[model samples]
Target: GDDMAILAALGLQSYRFSIEWARIEPEDGVFSQAALDHYQRCIDACLSRGLAPVLTYHHFTLPLWLARQGGMTSPEFPDRFARFCEHATRHLRGFDIACTINELNLPLFIREPLMARMTSEKALARIAAAEAVLHGSINSFFLYSPREVILNQGLAAHAKGRDAIKSVRSEIQVGVTFAVQDEQAEPGAEALRDQRREDFYGVCLDAVKGDDFIGVQTYSRVVSKRDGSSGPEEGHPRTVMGYEDRPQALAATCRFVWERTATPIIVTENGWAGDDDRRRAAFVPEALSELHDAIAEGVDVRGYFYWSLLDNYEWAAGYGPKFGLIGVDRATQQRRIKPSAVLLGDIARANALGADNRSAAAPQVMGDGAPVGL
Candidate 1:
């Protein structure tokens, strides 16, 4: 239903969208030719209009086969996933820009939704009661709340993402990408250190430990530490949902990665979710400023892509979080550019003029922690 004409109108040169696995391959190895044809048309349409297609092979969802076959936990997952990547990359060869994986961290939750899904009747009763409080208005941001808690068993997710990259490296200009909420450990709190917030983050980066490029997805920041305290306790003051106005922290994180890795980095996803145009505009500039500082300080930062071409389904949050430059009416799929989207268009134009030219340097933080063997 999406012609993506709004993006062309907004003057965006490149945009990233995922090839929904479920849509393409509803069954195991039984892909729909119609889906392939539709996708081909989509790709050709983008190229025809001078828009770069950064095709994502997988987002959070997967073919029911994979989910049925033990999902990522299956021993056969690596081989099957690699084969899938090989086929996808070969099929979409010569796309303008390319991404191998979507939000890598997100798969962590999708593979295990039960961690958050409440089964008790009492809980269901409470949810019904809570909805009654809204007086028929949908709590659009429901999934983002703590109740929908999906834990990332960091190492497992990282391994899957890494496997995806290695699978297609020989066939495509592939990169590893993940959605990251810039979580910070609360300063002066030993518990923050104990909770291993940094460890969890490091795992995401580790997924692409030795890749051609790394895609960093920035949405909000959440300072998550295991809260064992009784009530209303604060350990490390990480950003509330990963957006704590901490440009310095963002810069430091990038700098840390720069100091360590040899891979070129891309800001694959960075945006604010709000109704305020001014704040949203400020958000992009600030994140870019931090990125600029990281590059200047010797990070091989390559390109920056905003979180979306347009606001669509916010996953469990539905249509609530407006992380798009072109706002979407979920009901109508009509698109209009927010001021921030305009700012991005200007930046994209400038960058296209400049091209992706950068220098190479050895990482400064390459081995802060001893390397782990995969």
Candidate 2:
């Protein structure tokens, strides 16, 4: 397939892609061998091209049947997910690395009611409209209460899923991913920022402590003040997602997660979202340079997978945010590789950072260079 060929051309040694639960099991207690066979072809294609496939069992989409049954908050959710993982792993046995879930902490922040309450009226209206278009009705969104329930269920699902996969193939590596925001505090807000980090990520990071590795997905920097104000600063360059253009966030996030969990890290998702290929071209080298600095400093960082290989649908945002190294025409399904893809490909082929691409100044050190105690 074109995807495998392109990955091989770029000299990438690994490819990470997700399997849709809905596609594989459209109804409760029903399984489709055709879907399994289809994904098998994808796995075989990657192998033929000499690329190791890193498969993710879930990536934020629930089968309508599962959603109707209370999704993640359901007590049965973990067992159901583990059953699905057990089925999927039978087909994916040879692959050495598998992610049990993507962004386990995402549900806490993205629930409809929370967004409706926390965001501007205009932003809330846009989200409601997008939900209608994506799900056919705004009322269809899952609304779970007591945020702790969502976190607890996610942790349970991840633990069960990891165990299920390891049961099938004991040698396989299994872990869950987290979305880490590199939060900086204003002079009077250090404790507040620390508390926010604990509230958002601490539990999930603790859950994955004994797993194979943790997937750190970070893209920008957020500055928090004691008054609970937090967002990109006004003057910084922003990505299409409205995140500040802080390439060094990669290093800061790596160090932060390393200090907390002491688990091996894999950057499962990191990239800028924009239509300007030129900006992406420039952004990648800078981000990778920061990543290289993290590696040189004794963080057991394993690999980095760009956020995406193609511009595709982005949940409620739809196709508006472009985070791909390749562009696609929705009408004709045509593909065009962007300049940034080539830039990244060159770096992969060389297997070393280019001298010209080094950061002009020393990269920022995370956490005052102090030993972090969990």
Candidate 3:
């Protein structure tokens, strides 16, 4: 499916995409002019279609040479990242928003079994295999590679990277996005919830205070118990990702993150992951309503970019979990525009949802040449 044209057709105001660090800088000190030109074209493509381009510099991947040299733990990581950012931004002349790194908090792939989806022994074996392939303990956004050192390096990298991008495109709004949740507290769980919250987001939020904005990516809520985050509420609907279908979590998260950082908010991602197009169709309005209320209350949300435009790979989770308005048949490269696509497009065209400004419109098919779109 054509993402840029789809966004324009939907009448969405902006598009967010990542510039591949690995592709632009395949080797240390060796940058690709072709890679720079490719992303420059991508930026232009969005503008050519009347969509504002919101670019993310790093989205959980890195060049191989850097990974082989201890990855994020390498003493050279931050500077190398900044160097790449400055050089890349020079080619990217017109984009206005830049996220320095995506999801710098939560440690979503923190070697934890739930996220890694690997038993401990198999995890170790795969880690071994990673070492074999990269020649160093790989740190290129693996499902099991988020660690204190890695996140700490990311903090430094974000600072330097933000500066580098701003140095070239100072007019651009620079920021970082992190995974967030509603973080509801169960009985006697307030302390535990706050503790978990700090563990996941506190440090990163502290660092983001002065940035132009903070991107909050929330899919569901976490009902934290005294001991730990509880399983999804027993009676609530759940998504294929095994989380509660609480679209209102976006509101809770936006309020909390804005209170914490005082930076402007942009919903970097929020969507249900499943094959049920109705769930997505219903989810968008509920989430947007929540977001609308948050905005009404002055959370200062600048944008609400849905998690995705097409169903595609979901990191370690593979392609099983779907969170797209359009579905693709992998074998055919053919795209199926889901009902949710029309639903969201209608809301986008109306520029509002819920009872006040509901409208319906069919989706206009976009081109498929773009690597990723949202």
Candidate 4:
């Protein structure tokens, strides 16, 4: 496919995409020179095309070594993941931009039924056994939601990761991306739900507060609670996921976050998924419009990177949800540019041109603004 060419065609200034950890480091502790070179080439290509590469150190993918180490939830995991982050940043020090972690707030652990069942059962048994062996030890406590554990561990690792990157290349700009959902305030529910959303910001803010940028992945509204009397609503607006579809609420949440944090924000992944292109485009425009409003209201919103350049495996759902601007033919890996892709390309071109013109016309400065020729 024309992955690199497509980026150039889009005239993109900045593009955010994840490098599957498994793809890069398939075997534990073993570095693949070929893969490393390939990524180096990819980064070079982005720079060649004038597109800043926003590298995601970890998405949902994990290395086998880390996976065997009980993934992110393992107590030993924070150190292990820190080492991995140190290693990754060491290798990717010269990238255009770095997002140390992606979607750290997503409820990926409990959402996947099979994995959740296995994780809960396995973790409980392990914790129970540990508690028995270390009955008096203070570190014997157990917690559910390995993903949550991962968040705690990953944030620490992210800090180490940042230091590691700067040690090698001090010029690289690094940050973190959180999957933030805007929640709607329920009727008669007071503003408690709003507080919960604000608390969610703590997770993101805590992770990237010291970083150069904040990548916020926003999608449908976050439903705080569903009315139980809705009579078995499975699909449509009344569905459980409907509470997460509040666009205005999401915008407000963004505004709140921007007000609280001085860091520049980037909409790393904010787009809709639909069966057809038209619906997808409509949703994207709406989201972008909300983002624009947020920016206009002084949100310090910087760049926008659509969730995905292409559809990939969505964990348990695999390839079920098509959220890509470019439709991927899974069988052959061929990509078809959807209408949203075209629209994004146009938007990028316009923004880049606008930025260029603004810069070119700005008056030159000389020695504390004194006359240059005098």
Candidate 5:
């Protein structure tokens, strides 16, 4: 497909993708050999393209067979997850780096209010219907499940899943990725900011201490004010997702995650969703420059991958977010390589930053919204 070719054209060394559990095991205890073979071919494709295949075991999309049996709340949750891992490891070959799960600590509660307003009556009714179908219990997916249950079940799943992968292929480097933000404390808001950071990243960061690496997915900088409200700074440009255009956030999160866990880091996801390709081109270099600073300061930062290679469907937001380096012609499915892709490709090919990128990535009062080097 042109998708893999587009990424290779961007001179990227690796491509990270998650195998769909539902596609592999649509029914309970049912394994699809065809699906496994398909994924093996995908791995081979990446390898053939000279791109390393980085695999993620899970990415929020839980198999309905498991969800119907009480989702992550079921006592068999961890064991079931381990079973899938064992089969995947044994059948799917060719990825040395993998993530047990992606963004296990997402703050879904904050979006419920907005979703309620945006949701149609039919959608709300479907929720009621699903609950009734589950016998008046939690029928919602694990993403919408109770936070405590997610935390507990999540920890267990990672432990068992990691062991399952290692038991089958001891050489595979395994870890979990977390959605982290650059948590900034406004004047008199230090304690509140610390608490916010703890609520979002503390548990997951602490759990992956012994793993080979921890993946950090940071996009924007968030400020915690004394008034208990947090958001982007007033004057900065914002992404379509309403996040501030602060590329320095990547560096801040890298430092935050490394200082806490001391584990090796890989930036699994970091990019904004917006229509401004120019901003994205500028954003990429600045963010990577910030990340390079962290590496120079003794952080064991290994690699980084942009959020996506194509403008694909963004969960909950659909296909609106243009976070891709290659734009897709909707009707024709033709690929349009944006300037950002060329810029990144040149950087990748040279293994060095150009003078223009270096000048553009210079610090500009970005640190904590005050004057400091990014």
Candidate 6:
């Protein structure tokens, strides 16, 4: 209730939040009406404030019961997810946009089994402790690799979930979001970069080609070298996540995805992880300027929802990183709106960037005819 009020106060007309699968269904076939009712109240609250609700059906966490049964690797996973979607969508009245899954490509990059096998016992113990604190009662320890299993199962689940939603209420626009990085090739390593991009994100993009839209969740650019190293260029201004503060990365990423899928795009998540609100304030307009350039060049971008509205708990990093427009006092539960929140709110109200916030010049055209700049 307070969160919706804060969003309305920020002049935000749309809100994007996730619904945890574990909360909706604790057991295989058991559906919780109480959970559905709770989400309905949340939707109603958003509508009351003239805010359009964008709901993501699944985030990262899975019910402990389901996880024990092999989770995404289980043959029954996709169908079970579809059944849940059908039940949940029946209670949702005004949600226009829905995402079937959040960051389906994440598993390919962060292989938990491989990490656990490689890291020392001490480090693994620390990680286990952290997971315990982060997930509370949920036992999130997985001994096997669901990486390849999920890539295939996730697509099936997305398709089934989309069908399930449409079966119940045909008007909801459904798609899946991917964690995209603007990847560039070092001189003479173009093929390596292409292969890496395909390995990481190509399958997901190909799967969503026929969906209503594709959510581009980009934060930084990665350069692939001939020697197989990849990361942000040396000495660039870095975010708290150690990502390069390259606002122009968004434009290039949008273009790359649009060219391949030809699907309409919506920036699902884009924000910096830092304590400096001034840097965040500056980053927003600059990144928006690059997004504007992409739109000007004819990319069908539907909307931009900032990564977050408040400083909430991040998965592994916990609550240490501040990526919110409004700061939270954990002890007192107080909300303090930062200057960046006001700046973003004003931009939202205006529906366009102010003249001063525009990019300094036209993007520089690369050798391959791609325009790159902020």
Cα displacement (Å) at residue 219, model 3: 0.3
lDDT of 1 by residue, 332-362 (tens): 6676767776665555544421134222321
- Native-to-model Cα distance after best TM-score fit, residue 115 in candidate 5, in Å: 7.7
User: What's the lDDT for residue 190 in model 5?
Assistant: 91
Which ten residues in a row are the worst by lDDT in model 3? Answer: 361-370
RMSD of 4: 9.2
Which lDDT tens digits does candidate 3 get at residues 1-374? 16677667765667778889899988889889999888888888888987777888888777888888867768788999999989988877877788888887756425464554655788679878978987666644435454677567889999999999888878889998898888888889889888778877888889779799998888898787766655577788899888899999989998998899789877787788898788788888788777777777778787777877778688868999998777889999787877877777666666667467522211111212222122
lDDT of each: 0.54, 0.77, 0.76, 0.58, 0.77, 0.77
RMSD of 6: 6.1
TM-scores, all models, native as reference: 0.72, 0.88, 0.90, 0.76, 0.90, 0.89
Tell me the lDDT of candidate 4.
0.58
Which candidate leads the pack in TM-score? 3
* Candidate 3: residue 73 lDDT (0-100): 69
* Tens-place lDDT digits, model 4, residues 22-78: 666777667666776777776777677665666777766666555555566656755
Model 3 compared with the native: what TM-score?
0.90
lDDT string, candidate 6, 1-374, tens digits = 78777777767677788877888897878878888888888889888987778888888878776766667777888998999899899877878889898887787766754476648888677767755654542222233455567678888999999999999988888988888899998899899899878988888898889799998888899988878888888887898888999888888888989999999987888888799999989988888888888888878777777777888688777998888888889999998988988887777766667866443332221000000111
Q: Where does candidate 2 have its weakest 10-residue lDDT segment?
A: 365-374
RMSD to the true structure for each prediction, in A, is 9.1, 6.3, 3.9, 9.2, 5.5, 6.1
Sort every candidate by TM-score, greatest first: 3, 5, 6, 2, 4, 1
The collision pairs in model 5 are: none
